[model samples]
Target: MESEAGEREPVIIAFCCHYCAFTAADLAGTMRQQYPTNIRIVRLPCTGKVYVNMLLEAFVDGADGVMVAGCEEGSCHFLEGNYRAKKRVNYAKQKIEEVGINPEKLEMYHIGASEGPLFARKAREFTERIRKLMQEENEPENQIQNEK
Candidate 1:
């Protein structure tokens, strides 16, 4: 788990459900929760709103890892938003593999709006995985070309 030395901080992009994960993230902040500083959250009305294109765009934009945060099963704000996100993540995983990116760099998680500790734990866990992946010599290059 080696971080980029000297100056550059690791970059992570999280697409969070506005109803749950996003609010939990906000709560984490208000609670002064200590977690990795690498994560940058992008709020979406629902995980269903997070297109595969957006996930790829994050990788192309230099995110070391990307996570899609949504509500627990059957608890989505839009009824089936998390389900849609789960399906999309699977599709994106396959596409990313085809493009030479390690699919493990992507993750889909469920959180409750009041689960600030859970949110922080997920962030730490995801960040650790990214760190280890970055340190691997045989790491696959999954750099998707940025769209103009």
Candidate 2:
């Protein structure tokens, strides 16, 4: 939808693990790093707590894109939470594609608690990517409507 600035704004949902991703986000804020305001973060004890259904529900609830951010590989506080989160994210990607949404709209990221800059960069990048995807998805329909 268009925001007050008259620019199309996609709703991006970020599922972040408290041990790493969430902390990184907080650090980013403290560092005055800027990311897209369209991103809505949902904090989780661990990325492993993320489920495919939750990802799908985000879309159904009008999220244009979803991101699951977890600890770096082999560094999950729960030992294997990141690994399980990765698997679920991959599965969710496939399912989202089956429903005709761009699979790229959903992604998983491995982040260290110290990577605040990386977190901000990724949030901006992902937001732009989803914005482009949404534009592309609507282009054909807009053209058809114009043609009629």
Candidate 3:
């Protein structure tokens, strides 16, 4: 997972809503909760703005993982934006899987505006998941190299 800095740092691009997830992430920073530095957040007016192509592009452009973080269920500022984002995330996951990438590399999270600790925890958890995924993807090759 750590293949010389910037080679494979397990990066996750998080698309977060301004009212919910983005605010929660800001609170996480304010609270000084330590999470992985690999997360790159892109604040959006709503998670509904997240398109499947944007997600796929992230992977194509080198992101190891992608996350669409939005308001909790029944609490979206835009009424149904979070739900839309969730569906898009799932669809994007399927698309990536079809392209031979693990669907687990993409995730959707529901976080409230005040859930700072949860934001940090999710960030850490996603980073770990990507690390394990990368490790698993490399294991067979590593084994073959050792046998050689």
Candidate 4:
């Protein structure tokens, strides 16, 4: 997982809703489902409460990837929280892309409280994707240095 420049393990920030996403993560642990340990979960009362700045700050502070996990469509405890979160996540993705990072580094997911396996699977997948992206980001530097 270390890059050529001694890059450490990828750090992933996950904003999870209390009602669904958080519960799902808890269930994942209870079920002994395996996922990446690099993810740092931030519990939110509702996904709608997540601001774009919060997500951006995660990247600025060295998170290689970000994830917003909420209740399934039409099932948000706050009625429209998940929908609003989806829109905000999309907006953040675009902004990050403008700054030269791949938009794929940021993602949104909807998970029910009972979907522990799915949650774990997605977490693992996201971590692997970010690891690949980090490696890609370093490849050009390595090539240029090699040419010297």
Name the TM-score of candidate 3. 0.91
**What lDDT tens digits, residue by residue, belong to model 3 across residues 1-148?**
4666554788889999999999999999999999888999999999989999999999999999998899999999999999999999999999999987899999999999999999999999998999988888779786586466
lDDT of 2 at 93: 95
Distance from true position, residue 87, model 2, in Å?
Answer: 0.4
CA shift of 78, model 2, Å? 0.4
Model 2, residue 140: displacement in angstroms? 3.2
Model 4 weakest lDDT span, ten residues long: 139-148
Per-residue lDDT of model 1, residues 1-148, tens digit only: 3345643456889999999999999999899887898999999999999889999999998998999999989999899989999999999989898977789999999999999989999999998898777656233442232221
Q: Rate the local accuracy (lDDT) of all candidates.
A: 0.88, 0.94, 0.93, 0.93
Q: Show where candidate 2 strays beyond 4 Å.
A: 1-5, 141-148
Residues 8-41, model 4: lDDT tens digits: 7998999999999999999999999999889999
Candidate 3 segments exceeding 4 Å error: 1-7, 141-148
User: Which sections of candidate 1 miss by over 4 Å?
Assistant: 1-4, 138-148
lDDT of 1 at 136: 66
Query: Which of candidates 1 and 2 reaches a greater TM-score?
Result: 2
lDDT of 1: 0.88
Give me the displacement of residue 54 in model 4, in angstroms.
Answer: 0.8
lDDT of 2 by residue, 3-105 (tens): 7868679999999999999999999999999999998999999999999999999999999999999999999999999999999999999999997778999
* Candidate 2 TM-score versus the reference: 0.92
